[model samples]
Target: MTTARLDPDIVARLVGDAVTAPSMHNAQPWKFVFRRADDVMEVHGDAERAMTRADPHHRALHLGCAAALFNLRVSAARHGLRARVHLLPDDSQPWLLATAAIGGVPGEDQELAALHTALRRRHTSRFPFSDEPVPDALLDGLRSAARWEGCRLTVAGDWHLDTLLGLVRDAEHREDIDPLVRAETAAWVSPAHATSGERRDGMPAEVFGPRSSAGSSAVRDFGRDRSMADRGWAVFEERPQLALLGTPTDTRADWLRAGQALERVLLQATADGLATSMTSQPLEWPELRWTARDPLDAMGHVQMVLRLGYGPQGPGTPRRPVADVLEIRD
Candidate 1:
């Protein structure tokens, strides 16, 4: 019944909204294939764009792609449609993350639809935030957003925060020593793309924000040693308001759920007028990951470390043209 309505223009627009999702280094490591006959869109993770050293197991990649998946759901709901998803739908094709069968189940997902306004507004802010703490009430709403997506969002206390900060430093030290990791990260931070704006994807120099004069405890310093003119330094907040987004188990499926939950939390934060940034620096290392988790906390495994506060919104990163990542089949 809805097949006739799922035209190329509508599908293209939906995919365009989906690509606005944030990915690691803004790599935009995802692809969407729309099957007109079935009215389903296939989400695939692009191996060539994957951060080989940073995301060895592709866990972060899955989270990034899943974030895009969540945006697709939001777009569908906004258009009075529903996306029935099946994760890892094919055992034969590992990169084929999931497929969303679009059906016009209008009014069923008003909450997801409501997040549509925040889709473009949500950007990963890398600048310093004010010392003003986020309210407990607003934090609670963000927690609910994660819970609705079947994940846990834990606010880091003093001790936990210290541990997390240390881990970030440790990860930074490791990245400094590991040449592979540094090269991989540098590949995505494109200077030419920053000024020329020719490349469709990658984090440009301007979006790298300023250097953290506080020795980069709370945030990942992507500007490390890069002699980019006018990239000044700034002092970050004394105590960052950190949140841990976790899942019951660490698997491809769990990573997918984590991605959806991550975006939901981010979108909710944006809607609530909060500036946000996230770092997987600590979680990227297996040795540092387990230690980063609070032993007493019930969160089985941490999927992401997020910094939330009031601050200057980070400039938007580049994204692949919809034509570059989307394919339509008869």
Candidate 2:
């Protein structure tokens, strides 16, 4: 079958939607190159944006880029197009994460089209969530979404939830003692007192959420080294509804699959009127990362630890413009 020619304007617009995906510290670590000759948009991981101390192996970087690729699919479907994606198409060049070759108009995938509506709506929620339980049907839908991408979505239950929470706390302690990790986090998180040339990419002071006075750590501690006078305190839910995204393997392709699945779950949760937060805390530490896996489940490798609840949506973070991130090569 011959591939349909893609419109240049459409390529630009689809990439615009893709960059809205969330990344660690809002690093926005992705670059897209559209090859008009063969009709493919290549996604590349920008090593410059990689967090050296926090994510040395670039796993988080791959996840962020793949999430953007997922958004690209949503954008394509919304605009009546289809994207045929191939992960790590070139082994010689490891930085090239995937390539979504533009194809004919999108066919009848109503579910994918539906997620397009949530692409912009989904944001990380750092505020406190109410103790109310999420409906079983909604959680099941999210589980199915992850399963579609060859990953497992396991919801932590009872004692398992406590273990996950303790793991987060342990990760925080590790971050505290490691000066290099603290410095990396501090570099990305802006301080309230910093003079004018502040960055738009990292975690800003306004959305740091409140510091936990009761001693339970949030997924990530944006407030660890900074003191913002305007920030206020609130009580987090006693038991946070947490879920884990895992895959059978830890290959780069697996990371790519897990990343797409992670974004799908988040978007679905957003559409269902739920707020979400993610912590790679345990995943960041090789030793602690394995313990995050549930013994009852056959989840081979945990990719991300997610917190889902009903709470205030996180403030919208910044992104590099489509023009800056996407390039068209005729």
Candidate 3:
């Protein structure tokens, strides 16, 4: 069958939607190269943007890039096209995370296309969530979303939730003493760096949310290193409703799959009128990450800890221009 020609404008639009995906510290560590000849778009992880101190193994980087890849698939489906994706398409080039050959009749992937509306709507909410518990039915749908992406999403039980919360605190304490980790986080969350308006990546002060009034919360505190004017403190939920996203194994391929699963669940939750945020703090520390997995549960390796509840969605952060991240080649 002859492949339909993917116009340059369509490719640009797809990439535009893809970059809206959340990344570690808003690093946006992915690049796309579209080849008109074969109608393929290659997603590559930007090594320079990788967090060497926190993400030494580049697992988080891979996850972020894969999330963008998932967004690309959703964008294609919304546009009445189908994205045939191959993860880690080239072993020789480890940075090449995936390649999507976009071309298909309209209305081919209705389910995926349905998520298109949530692409821009989804944001990482760091503000306080009300005490209202999420309905079991909604949680079940999120679990199914992860399963569709070859991963698992398990709602944390009371015991597991407490354990995970403690781990998050432990991770925060570790970052407090570790100069390198603290520096790395400060670099991303600094107002001076973000206020310049020249750089399009990294977490800005506007989305840092309020400081936890009482104590440590499930949300990652981006303002720990520096103080901001009018950054008032607020009481977070006493018992946060957390969910764990995991895979059967811990490998680059598994990380990529988990990332896609993460985005799927997030988008589904957003579409369902829920505010969501993710914390990889515990997962960043090896000891804490290992303990994060429930030995009795079927979920093997925990990849991310997500907070889902009723709250205000986070403000939109900046993203690199499509011209910077996407390159068109013959």
Per-prediction tally of clashes: 0, 0, 0
Candidate 3 lDDT over residue span 181-235, tens digit each? 9888877775754556677888888888999988899999888777687788999
TM-score of 1: 0.97
TM-score of 2: 0.95
Model 1 per-residue lDDT tens digits across residues 79-147: 989999899999999999999999768476889999999999998988999999899999999999999
Clashing pairs in 1: none
Q: Positional deviation of 264 in candidate 1, in angstroms? A: 0.5
In model 2, which range of ten residues has the least summed lDDT? 191-200
**Candidate 1 error regions (>4 Å):** 1-4, 192-195
Off by over 4 Å in 3: 1-4, 106-108, 192-196
Position 258, candidate 3: lDDT: 92
Candidate 1, residue 154: Cα displacement in angstroms equals 0.4
Give per-residue lDDT, candidate 3, residue 252: 94
Error of 3 at 292 (Å): 0.4
lDDT of 2 by residue, 1-330 (tens): 444387778888899899889898888999999988888999999999999988989999999999999999988888777889999999998899999987776776457888988888888888888888999999999999998888889899999988888888898889889999888878778765223445657877666778666666554768866656777667788888999999998998999999999999999999999999997787888889999899889999999989998988977776677888888887
User: What's the C-alpha lDDT at position 145 in model 3?
Assistant: 97
Q: What is the lDDT of candidate 1?
A: 0.90
